[model samples]
Target: MTKPTLPNTTSSSNQKLPSTAHSPVFRLRDMFKPSFDLWVISWILGLVTALSMITLLMVSGWFITGAALAGMIAVGSHSFNYMLPAGIIRMLAMARTAGRYGELMVSHNAVFDLLKTLRLRFFNRLAALPLVQQRNTLHASQYMHRLVSDIDKLDEFILRVISPWLIASVSLLLLAGFIGWALPLSATSKTIIYLLLLSALLLPLMASLKGIQSAKRLSQVSESRRQKLLAPLAIITQLLLWQQWQAQTKSYIAQDDRLQALEWSAQKLRSSYMLLIQWFFYAAVLVVLFSIYQLTDSSTSLTTGVDVPLVLAVTLGLLGIQEIVVPLGQHYLALGNSISAKDRLNALLQPSVSEAQANSTIPTDTETGLALPTGPLHANLTHVSAKIPGALVGAKEVSVRIDSGTPLIIKGPSGCGKSTLLQALAGELPVQSGEVKLNEQDWFAYNWQDQLGYLGQQLDIFDQTLAANLRLGKPQATEAELLSALDKVGLLTWLQAQPQGLQTPLGEYGAAISGGQARRVALARLLLKPRRVLLLDEPFAGLDNETRERVWDSVREHQKQGLLVVVSHHEWDMGQCDVLTLKENVFID
Candidate 1:
């Protein structure tokens, strides 16, 4: 079988391209704003703790230097005290360990709080965006990956990336200050060394930016291919009779080889970059050692022969600076990947063109709490067409109307735009060249959500209790009201037969129930949501004859209360209902 091809339009091409800047960073910053106070407190505490640890390391070096000097004096027949140095080292170590633990606790809490905020913001943004817009931008799996994987990258940014650099930087600055005040090494020399180390750290990052972008793109492609391969392979048992195992294996191997090549190329580039960084690191260490040696030799009279304590401190500090650069480089690389992922997610969460505005007025009926005007509804379409990408053109010049509380049966072959017409009526589909009106008012003029209840051909069920799914239509509905709706839909007996009754979990997409039962559950939900108009797309397609009759009966019973528009190829025995046949042209009576 041939693989499906996506559209070759400009919009399709544009979607294939990735954004230059990661747009989600700005959004993430906004999300973290609420936790700023806790973040600030945590950062301050972390800095203090880091300083304490650094001080302890420095004091331990001093103790070592003191013990060596005392031994030297003892060999020269002189006495020197080592008790003070030992006591101070022990005290500093204890304090440093305690401070480290405290900092960890505070930082963990702060980062977790920020992560929660990010998750909420991401979900809220998705909620605000229109469904069609989201579908156009990202696949459901990609969105899930971003929500799980990309959000996790922030943890690396905080813990493995930012905190260590911060601590190292502050410690270096404090050491430089103390050395300039207490030793003969001029502040100018220290400043030069610091600049050289900074250059070594930054040069690799600048050189690797383009490479990082390339790697990220390649990784995304690789991931997409992997998902494509796995999704079908997962259902292989179902297709085993038809699909050849050898052919499938060969195809997967070919795709895997292509992705592996790209991955290897990226890895090679990264390795080269790291090699350069390693060389730079060695050069920087040599430069630091030479500078210290020159300073000590030149100021022999200005300070006692290069105190071992200070020399050891300088060596350890330089090593810490070197350690800092590696994390910084890795941080930048990780950030590039995260930014790319975030940008994709941000595009998905952008508002749709058909997004409803706040303060939009909705027509309402006082008695039924349904959104329909007092007059009759006349829907019109003149040269209207819905051109969806990768799908058939929905409908053209499809003009139809139903007077108050009339049942209209839309008859057409599959993919003949029957559902599209109903969707247009519900305001889900955009009218390209014509208008749709409810109660003679422009559909856009009134909020349509409260006015219409739609059930698509494919029924979707959540992994929740059966009662929870029904309650989605009416959250405040009591058990008695729910039982009544179930009874009306002829599902009450089935519900009672379940081991847990209404409290039974439906599993993902109602996987625990049969197709007919899932349809009934959806029907129950629709019944609970009182609406002025109902748009059902083959709601009875998968039901048995008896269940189908019951559902049809339920629709006929509800017709007197509101308008019912149904799209189905199956024959119905309803009386006094007008049938609208949609062939090349819509025929309505």
Candidate 2:
């Protein structure tokens, strides 16, 4: 039977890519993915912040101008109490300060919470992907960039994106209601209010559209720089010994230069948008001033005594609205970054086949189901082949079978398929042909993931304490269990020498320790949770010979309980263990 294929083109020159389950319109609710209550408080605080500032500025202006006029007139001091306005001014000032601080605190907490959610989801997705899918540097870097940086940029979703538009919308409505009540019903009042309304909405909409392409490009280049910069940092010694550091440094400098150019382009566009908005504000100010002049040029009007203060209030209110509306202009980049990051992430992290086929069940019918054996864990591979989704080469027509009490060592030349075979056995890949089974059942059918332990060549060290990192493998492991595992991996002496021992922070990516120590720490983590089957890929790559022997001795002790599969270029002494040699798509024992 032929497998499925997505249409590569449609009726247009510019083709639409097939949409995946991961694609969705970015929502403000996602900003509160971790803590809804905190997000709600953040939004309320933001509203309070804007309302307080508007009230403080307009009320202060009115009170100051009105007091001056009252003092100048003969009936001045006794006409009204001066203390009320003065006290209100002081109260508004205090409210504004407190609201601003609360807004920052709540919103920042919301942002940090959102970031934690994103990082956890990202790592989980990567963990779920097949090794073949993971080997694509393009895909991996994009995932990493999103995991480390794009999620941080998304904090703008709060301050710039949602909060600005919401506050602006609410302010406009309140201003319109207040002006309609306060001003005389005239052509001038109608014109000022309508123009103010249009300008308030139109200016931001235009600004959001203007620099979008620049914003999009900057986001892309920023991701590229992150991928390039971190890759070399992870393998600085190898690159330096290969004598490629100078070229890498020069290329990184070029990336930085390109970044500067992109930022300058975005800056130019943002500046133009800002200056244009300021002009619209100036026009609104002139209209308000003209309206005030028409109202108060003479002293016999109905609102005569209050006219100066009213004028001050109206003019200052308009200015405050302009200030509140400015943040919306800077929100373009947030949208751009979100779109880019989501697209890249969705492409790499499609849901697993088991998840998609959740309702499908295994049957004991003779036509299809094979009866599983008892007493030992069994894995059988028959002419199985697996490949990276878009790559040119992979394993083909390889066959193998192993059960408990067998240690399998896969030996092959470079570009052979040992790693891919291990991934297939680990349930990380589906065979394009033939079959793989555990105990006579499809490996994915019976919760086999819990029964398997896999340690790949990649060294993943979280920013956590030593014990905390080790505890990830088996969260409920006791202190004695941890110490036993560390001793098995030869990290006990090293752990004791640390100032804080198990409490010591590993820093970012385990930068606090040496390469061999990091590897052993990872191995210790693996040892903390023993599984029915253990697959170790290059577990001894950076270890000394004695440490490697000790590691093998520790693992060999577990051969009775289950199977062991190791992939390595270096030869080791094997006592009755099976060896599979893969060459040009053939497996030989």
lDDT of each prediction vs. the true structure?
0.62, 0.69
Where's the lowest-lDDT run of ten residues in candidate 2? 1-10
Off by over 4 Å in 2: 1-27, 75-77, 121-139, 209-214, 225-262, 295-306, 351-372, 376-380, 387-394, 401-407, 437-446, 458-557, 560-577, 584-589
Give the winner by lDDT.
2
Q: Which runs in model 1 stand beyond 4 Å of their true positions?
A: 1-28, 45-54, 75-81, 134-140, 143-148, 154-161, 186-192, 204-220, 227-305, 351-371, 376-384, 584-589
The C-alpha local distance difference test score for the whole of candidate 2 amounts to: 0.69
RMSD, one per candidate, in order: 7.2, 7.5
Q: In candidate 2, which residue pairs get closer than 3 Å at backbone N, Cα or C atoms, i.e. clash? A: none
Best by TM-score: 1
Can you write out model 1's per-residue Cα lDDT over 70-165, one digit (the tens) per residue?
676577644656777678667767766776677778777877887787777777765443434444445456567756666666555456445655
Q: Can you write out model 2's per-residue Cα lDDT over 1-589, one digit (the tens) per residue?
A: 0001111111222333224334543444566667888877877877787888888888888888777777777453588678898898889888888988998898777777788887787666655443334444335656655656665666665667677888788887787677666766467666776686778678778667655566678877876776678877888999899998877777677888899998887777667666667677667767766665676646564355436676678778877887877666655566666655665555446544432232123121222323334478878878878655554567888889887887888888866878877766664454556776677766544444345677766667889999998988888999999999999988888878888988999988889888778877887887876567788887787787888888888877854678788898877675778888888543332
Q: What's the residue-level lDDT of 479 in candidate 1? A: 93
